[model samples]
Target: MSYQSDINPRHSTWRKVRHTLSIVSHEPANLLGALLLMLFSWIILAPVMSVLLNAVLVQSGDEGRTGATEGTFTAWYLLRTLTSRMSELLLWTPLLNTLAVALSTVAMALIVGVALAWLINRTDIAGRKWFATLLIVPFMLPSWTFALAWSTIFKNHAIGGQPGWLEAMGIQTPNWMAYGYFPIVTIMVLHYAPLVILIVGNALKRMDSQMEECARVLGASRGIIAFKIIIPLVRPALLSSALLIFADCIGEFALPYILGLPVHFDTLSTGLYRAISTRQSGVAAVIATVIMLMGMLTLMLDMKMLREAKRFVTLGGKGVMERRRTLGRWRTAAAALPLLFVLLGVVIPLLTLFLSTVMILPGRFTAENFTFDYWIGHNLDTVALHNGILLTPEFWHTVWNTLVIVGSASIACGVLGLLVGYAVMRCHFRWVAAFLRQLTFLPYLVPGIAFATAFLSLFAVARGPVPALYGTPLILILALIAEKMPYASRSGIAAMTQLGKEAEEAARIAGAGWFARIRRIVIPIQAAPLATGILLPFISGIKGVSLFVILATPATDVMTTWSLRLIDYNYQQAANAVVLMIALISWAGTVIIQKITGTGLADGLEK
Candidate 1:
């Protein structure tokens, strides 16, 4: 009897282990969720931690300055960056410049973006839909388009290059007009104003009209109603837009580098680039760390503002009427405003690019100066030229590189984003879901330049199983994927949130595994959004410059990097042609996304 009892105890324990294993093995969703969570932590968290570590650790051969051995912790970087004599030039000045440009850009964007949103959402403006659709075109194009256009028009002899159009017309463009804060702010406002319009416009559309009606009944003036009630209601959205615009501008490298480099006007992004270019790894790490800290602060502020916004929720289960204001005699004028913006932002820049491409001598508008050689002629003899752009092996190679790299990265982004969305939206464990969401979104909040720097520092050397990725195409692809995850994940989550659990649950009860359910039931229903999730990253990756410029090599030169090289070599015509091609591709992708999903790019972005 004693032997039987001992044997029974052991057998019972074995049965319990089997039962637990069976239960866990059946819950494939949980398994997949856990797997994805680990992968994200390793890929995203490791690089961030590396940047922070690099800021404090004494790198090899730095023992003399810190009096500490390599790999040892030191406060020398902090002391030198924050308190040393070069602090002003290194940290404070760039910081101030970033703030100034960001603030100025926000002020202008608010004026333009808010007014346009109000006109479209509230007022009976003429051609409202057409105007609204066209205004967002600038956002799809790169932030540097305006800067490049401005340079083409107003570039002076100060830089010793081909003179601008105005200069060729016997006009001496002033130094202030050609470059610096003014042009940088102008370009950023046009590029980012769409963000404000989208956010604030959504808020405006959902806003209850009862408060405004009551104010109207109280005999309040139009201005008074706008100042007292309307503005207050949308304040959270405006604040959110401002924060987004500031974050975008603060990390912007392309526009500032193009316009500010000639005059030594450096922002934080430019400073980081300069540090990296000069092989100052420690300084670059410190700068990247600072940028990340700033980003975290903005994120916290955004969270707080959003939390407070929840208190003022006017949309409810009740039927709320949104009354559009009559424009009376000003309808035409309101319509003209958007047309003007489009003219300045899109039409003019594209027209300038086309003109620059056809001109044998850039900025010379003479009939004799026009030639199709840059487009299709042989024996071009230009920088990095073989034949014309269409017939050249080099150009086609760049195009193929773009397709392969962007294609690979985008597919990865789409799958990961979808999985992340499913996990977060349907996760039973609340803390795990929250953690996953936050980690997935962290890459979005980090500046592109800073993120690139972190990846370079982390993967430059082989760490255990991960081989050194320096001077390789894989690093570029990895960086692109990380930076684009937020867009896809956000869209996926928005789509999944609207989906009910009934369909998925039915599949589960019918013995559907996690992968099977996702493929057959969940993804089929969300096909449009899934396609959009893939297409958004694909579009953005094709035109991405700031993230890949530092990591790109000659062998991995995509369209954007190739264009940058052409610019460096003063091949303006070829560069302009490349820019136009990029814009066309991006626009076509946006159109495809819109056609498939029945939602505009702005709608997907806002969601």
Candidate 2:
């Protein structure tokens, strides 16, 4: 109150306005950045607004029942979603399962990933580099790949499918082991653990080892050192990995759909997918909003943990080198453990898929049962599909669709990301910079299916200036651009942070305009990261299913959707072959990008 009373209040409104305008006008880039930021905020917020609106507004049938006109606001959806008899099954149970899976995944990923991080970064283990490289292979593969592999091995005839490999080998797998939470959690762990590994491994690699040696000289026990010193030091990485894994698993749909649908076990993502498919738009909106809120809350918690962790920073101006731990007899065991994980996560799953692709009947290894029909043979007998995937027009159509959609989306993401990085790093206004940064990250936190549904609601009908985009490839591209912006933006920001403004400033002094400066100076300097940003999303999009699954129509089928359709018709061999092809394509794209950029996937991931 005292400060407020003492503050000068003599500035005229006109003067304030002129001052602000002058500040912006002096730097055209600032003006352009501000406008772009506002436009991007509108783009990102549109679907979210639509989701909120859809949740409250009554549809035609609902309006008829409630004696209200269509699109009129009503509490009926909220009442039903929150208080109805079906609420338990519709909302609470799925929410609980989602939390459980997210928590369990965090626990599993941290244990395996952190241990591996320690082993690779701090120990004299054999094949450390090989383990470090191979462990992340599963991350590149789609999560559903693991789900398919799991089903190929452990599936039973309990639900009227062909017996799995275990059954073929005369070992009966329980339904619990084959599907639902167990398999879902396991598959997610394998898929996401690599993220944890990369983050924690990088932290451990950069850590100063002198502190540990000092603790050892101080007569600290190994247990004491681990709990009192090591744990506290790596806590930031541990918490970060946990936050990422939790956020990802909560939004994950493919594994839950493939593994949970048969047994009627639903997570938030699968539930949202079913709601949208069944045309329960209002219910779907509510679920999506809830998931978005959960993501925000988790992100907030991550921020809080990060703030606390900042107090424990170990890096300093002093040069410190990490010393490897001598494992002696335990070295072989440590190396074997990582190799075993690679075998379990990478080798086994891929082998299962390849074997299934060749098998006339999935899970049967008999020579007479093996065939190339799914891969190359013509005139193959299947449901709607009549030939090998390689021989089908449908396959080529999907390949074309994939290239067009993913390529366009990748370019959009890369350009937009570069602009965002430029604005956030170079802008003078604090609030505008912060807003743009957070807004760009919004899509990554929202569940893919929920985000797709939001897209459907917002774009299904033409409103005002925006035209209808539903069922079009444009919608798919837009959705992908939104969902993948986080990756591209982060890459751009990291690259840009390393670039000095001196060259750009000099270009400006020499009478270069904003666009010219960016084109000639910024783009050339940050080309590697720009390439990585574009290519990472392109690789991810090539095999992506969850984000586009809700949006793809028959005419718009990509490889993943095509494989899911094949699976639906019980064409296991064709489906497996399609999945294998997708893996190869993604791998090839990653390699090509790395080669072109002179940066490996591991290097990019570590950044």
Candidate 3:
């Protein structure tokens, strides 16, 4: 009996030691993966939940609050917002207005984008090389660039400031023509259509002409063949592009912030910005949630449609290239459209910014008034201004801060994106894949303002064991990493998906460690996309203003924020110069990245 008892005790103790060892010796990849996923989930969910929490918890306006601020379990805020003041809070007025603008943009893109895509892809159009590259250039530039140019071109004397270029030429541009829905929609359409053309054109290039030929042999008219065969085939891609544009427009802040502000044309994006900037944190959160819900709904719908139809999925077979469609005499008109599009969106805006930089006065373009104070001034003795960008120490500091923030953020996002992609794609568990995919993609669904606002709460205080990230460049990097991981993760996943587990398995059989295999084999193969993954965030981070608008301090200020400050003080000329510098830098980086790495914002396609 004593022997039996002793054996039982030993067995139990052995089991305990085994459990302890298991806990201590878990794989680093798995442990780190769990920790990272948990961190991301908390960062994304906490702020959203905070909004939900505040929505329910009563705040006593006994402290004297106004608007949505006065409330307590009364449902007054909800009822009031949904009912009589619904027009203001639901912002149906702006909502409807934004919808019209969005739909108009889509319509314009469909017409213009399809024409350009066909001309470039199928026709022997003139300057095919330059047109393809220059045509979509507007897509790379910030959306507000066009809006700023529009203001420069036609001030309409409604804003009560300096007259614009047309006015300088003795033209009286009307208010409706210059400011409201007409111009806002027009600018957005031209700015956004390049995306459609690129996305749709890529699809077009891969389309099988055999189907069209099959229809033609069956006595189908050319128009019928084109409409029935070509249009239907490309419809799926067009819809996807349109949906993305819609989501983008829903989150748009700067365009409306710039163009709509002058005319009092308030979209939800602008409205939400006002709410936050004015300290209506709760309302802004609510607006943000609403916008996010809209985006989520669209995403869900798109996914559902994609699953149901499955038509958009590209077949892996090689795309059979066909004869180029001879444009006949109409080729001139076809080629001219792309240049016209570029002129409106890219060339004109660039010209405006260039001209504005040279001119001393706002609208007047002359030689004597022009000075180099903004670019290369010695003392900036031009009164009340800092010295030239080249001469100023502050500008250099800001530029350095921008590089650090963007560079660090890009690397962080690239590594995280790669890790997430590896785990989600290669891991065996279904939940891990689903959870990682959903969470990484969640930020895309959240509006940038909401996402930024949520992080504001997150890093606001140092938790008991957690360090505060506020006021540090690390905070900006973290925000950018979170905001950008969506795309980086997507590109990584796509690249890794194309490359199967054969190489990884071979390394494992040779007893190679995980890190070595990833470094030598995986990265080298996926170098272009991985590099692109870094380049994109770097460019985007350097250019981003909306996400940093709330987070920027003098210590953490980057180029975009610095330019924004200049704009706030109405230093339009200096702001223009800064923007030009930013564009040039991004353009140069894009060229370097593509020339060396051989990938672009699109995949590896040269077009």
lDDT of each: 0.84, 0.83, 0.74
TM-score of 2: 0.93
Residue 175, candidate 3: Cα error in Å is: 2.1
lDDT of 3 by residue, 360-467 (tens): 676665678787777886665444466776676767788999999889989888877777777777655557677878888888877776677777756766857879
Q: Judging by lDDT, tell me the better candidate of 1 and 3.
A: 1
**What lDDT tens digits, residue by residue, belong to model 1 across residues 260-304?**
988888899999999888876777889999998888788679879
Which pairs clash (backbone N, Cα, C closer than 3 Å) in model 1? Answer: none
Better of 2 and 3 by TM-score: 2
What are the clashing pairs of model 2? none
Candidate 2 wrong stretches, greater than 4 Å = 1-26, 315-317, 500-502, 505-511, 601-607
For every model shown, what is its TM-score relative to the native structure? 0.92, 0.93, 0.88
lDDT of 2 by residue, 1-607 (tens): 3545554556566778888899887766577568867766656778888898988998656666657898889877777777899888889899999999999999998898888778877888988777778888989888888888898889887777577888878899998999899999888888888888888887777678888899899999999988988888888889988997888787888888888988999999988888888888888888888888888778778878878877877866558767999999988887987898898889999999998888877656689999888778877766577888898889889889998999999998888888878888887788888888888888876767778888888888898998988878998998898889989988887887888889988998999988899899989888888887888889989988777888899888888998888777777777888899899999998888869787664662232
